[model samples]
Target chain A: MAESKKPDSSRRSERSRRAIYEAALALVGETGYARTTIEGIAARAGVGKQTIYRWWPSKAAVLLEAFLDVAEQAAQGEPLIPDTGDLEADLKLVMRATVDELNSPPYDAPARALAAESVVDPGLAAEFVGRLLEPQLQLYVHRLRSAQDAGHVRAGVDPRIALELLVGPLAHRWLLRTLPLTHAYADEVVEYALYGLAPRP
Target chain B: MAESKKPDSSRRSERSRRAIYEAALALVGETGYARTTIEGIAARAGVGKQTIYRWWPSKAAVLLEAFLDVAEQAAQGEPLIPDTGDLEADLKLVMRATVDELNSPPYDAPARALAAESVVDPGLAAEFVGRLLEPQLQLYVHRLRSAQDAGHVRAGVDPRIALELLVGPLAHRWLLRTLPLTHAYADEVVEYALYGLAPRP
Candidate 1:
């Protein structure tokens, strides 16, 4: 409903793409990954089946692109982890933003559907992680590497694994619904992960 | 196919129940939670529909019970986390066992199905956590509390949240398939979570 008044070919194509993404996300959210189909998305988006098939090879691919589009918009095309020199505050700010995004209605349901589907489907899981999840993870890796260079993080720490120490808890809590993923919880995750759980000198 | 030679009521019931758990796990593993049905489970288990209905209210209930049975048997009824004096070694041992369970075929597929279902289904997720995940988490909580008493952990650390630093990485790696969840990765999770990512004193 929020398309531009301009009728250029580029504008029209963008509108159609956005509409298809919305339809795909809503379908997967309500009906789940198993039932969501390319035909269903095309019908809901008011586009031809050929159009969807032309743009993406399969329903999984379409959904995957849609997910990437949504996630990019969620971060507003900025790097997820900021490099503001002060690591702790930056981590808190970014993590708090993640908490908000994870809670937001537009992104929440479809992401959960995709995540749920990925669990049983190994190939899908690998593709989704490689394309979508790992890139975002690399944002943390970049930030952590910068942190280590700044001496904010230990030189001995592996940025890849170190990032998991941060992302894993939030993902676990968010995906499992075991507890509330509040800003407070996000802050605590950062604090505990950066400091020794043992008695510190 | 493994029913007993004995025709006594209790013995027959026991065999039937095992068959049902096996059937439910297989169906869910292959077909996923959305498509798995009580009728299918009944047919696969060689039991009548009324027999399934007599024992469980819904497919969710049947799957839940089946998952509990499998998880229990996976651990061989051992305590999830050992209460040995060294918290790091104990966590690594438990996490290694977890990696093995997650790799095992019978437990892997069915557990993934149940976990995936739980993500989008609130009631199922709640029951799964309350009955399965959290009870297991509380086992770590007990171990952490013991660690605190032994002066291995900071008294100020919340055992509940503290345990997440250990389990969350493993769960995230397992559920998402972002990385190979090996014993080495498990050991790294234990090390990073315990001593943390910052340069130590």
Candidate 2:
């Protein structure tokens, strides 16, 4: 509210905000969550400590906001997956984008760090799941519900749990770093998940 | 090899071995993997540092062995899932055991700690997937293959990938602590994976 009143300083404030977000992401990636501090972020961003404090409450808040900013940027003003009326194709498009985003370095390092840290820190993990992840997942649920209405999906199957079949394998592979995640793999996941892994008699 | 030659001292060695395993698991659970050291484990175990060295090469090795011991003990001489020839029933039986084991405290804390660390450490994660996790996964593959042979599963489905559909969701939920892992949930995973989310013609 205070920032909007001073129109002249808005651009400079925006620049500082972006710098702080970038700085927080970089520092968290380099130092890991336990060691990354608000002071370090401030110094890296070339901003004063009070500037950081004026906006965010704690280091977790900064990192979470930084990640949220990165995610929003990744979306490029489109918050929801494109509903092309074809669930499989639409899913493939979004999953492909996800595969591409994960492949990119700008988001990978910080996202991976945050994910690793979240595993140990339950409070941060809850925030991450509730705020950052579950919203995206709910979008998938919406898409699946549309599919159910279209008779593409089995009506009895719960959209929420069914969605995990698509996501769980991808997430499992990503978190464990067990295998290479490719666009082809994403397509396969979409296919296998939607078409069924069993022999269709 | 060398220890087995001296059969006379085997009883005392067994006691120290059990104590060290317990100490390693406890310390890692309490302080996490990075802070855990051979000296600390030895001190906690009431054994000398040399004793740990004689048995395991590094902290990772100790934790790996400790986890393996816990897993083996959890099975209580029943290591492999029963090949009851009924694929669905067999999978449920095993997955239910997994749900119970994860919910129980004896192994939960240390296993969670190890999994958290493994996410950040690629080499250890690879070894974990290859040496420890894959062998167990391959057992699923074997069972799935038998199911395929019996015409219970679609022969075209890759048993390796199919197994992940069952294992991945459970692991994802367990790792994230997103929800209560129950026998019912495990049963659902087996059903959904086998039958899939698409309409069955």
Candidate 3:
């Protein structure tokens, strides 16, 4: 009977965790980050405030975890960019997927809310970079290293920096809303990063 | 006597405007955008709230114009990227200057505040891109066009899109705080954008 109770409690904990994540994302999306509160999240999730405080210390932590969960779900448990032996094709596929995600409503609002707050909050910015952005970027780093091994990428190129050439332009266009972020734009970014802008010598 | 009085009033108005710009910048820098208000700006500037409202519609407007004033001052009235006939050298110089400006305290704080707010605020983002970012980007467009004319850049490259390759990475680093933004980083971005990351065929 004690063993059965343990399993039931663990199952309930998992359900509560999922509910909290959903509530945090929806609340941040609807109200900006500055306005989102632990109370609001707890209420929306139909869990007690103590439930959130027991699990997370702050709103930023909750939002960061929520974003990470959403990103993981989007990647279907595989967060790495695919390597089809064609570096250019693989990058385009990943970039196009990024464009779609950025354009989607579910991801856009909450991500923007967190990103906005991070700009002014150095502590949150560091955590965001350390936990969310860096891990994803490392995936690109591994992909580029493989390309270098296969002679697809230049041997001297730093995969860390080279990946920026692909992702940076997309982030800029999306964040600034300077232009329409299209699949075509993503393809062009991949091509430009892979080929010389100067005429081939 | 009437003409002399007219000049005095105009001088007084100009002085008041400069004071307001300074106050707005300082306040926004000290407090995040959400906390900055017209009353705070007016008190700091030693003017009535009506003075600020008479010239600007809202706090966003006041902050935007203040940023523009600071940018113009930084450019010293010459806002165009220098055209030295060496495309790589010219780009590197401009990029390095940008890195310096982004690192400076006076520009960094308020700019971050505005950038943060713009991320969640679509209306302000549009105004920001339209009024500030696009005009500056056009300078890069003109320079890239000249490079194409001189056979320095491939004619097939679109100056507008190509310019993103230069500025985007720098901005990504600056906004995300993912890495140290240095002149060396700026030079490398120019090199990668001009030469490409893939090996020469």
Q: How close is each model in CA RMSD to the real structure? A: 3.1, 2.8, 2.6
Q: Give every candidate's TM-score on chain A.
A: 0.94, 0.94, 0.95
Error of 1 at A42 (Å): 1.5
Number of backbone collisions per candidate: 0, 0, 0
TM-score of each: 0.95, 0.94, 0.96
* Tens digit per residue, CA lDDT, model 3, A95-199: 999999999999999999888888888899999999999999999999999999999888888999998998899989988889999999999999888886888
**Which 10 consecutive positions of candidate 3 chain B have the poorest summed lDDT?**
B1-10
lDDT ranking from best candidate downward = 3, 1, 2
Off by over 4 Å in 2: A1-6, B1-8
CAPRI tier for the interface of model 3: high
- lDDT for A198 (candidate 1): 82
Chain A, candidate 1, TM-score of: 0.94
How would you encode candidate 2's per-residue C-alpha lDDT over A1-201 as one tens digit per residue?
876677767878899999999999998877678889989999999999999999999898999999998899889898568887888889899988988888788887788788877777789889888888888889989989988999889988888888788778878888887778888888877777877656788
Name the best candidate (by DockQ): 3
Residue-by-residue lDDT tens digits, candidate 2, B1-201? 787677777878888999999999999888878888999999999999999999888888988988899888888898578988888899999999989998887777788778877777788898778877888889998898988898988767788778878888898888776767899899988888888777888
Instruction: For candidate 2, give the lDDT of residue A126.
Output: 92
Order of candidates by DockQ, top first?
A: 3, 1, 2
TM-score of 1: 0.95
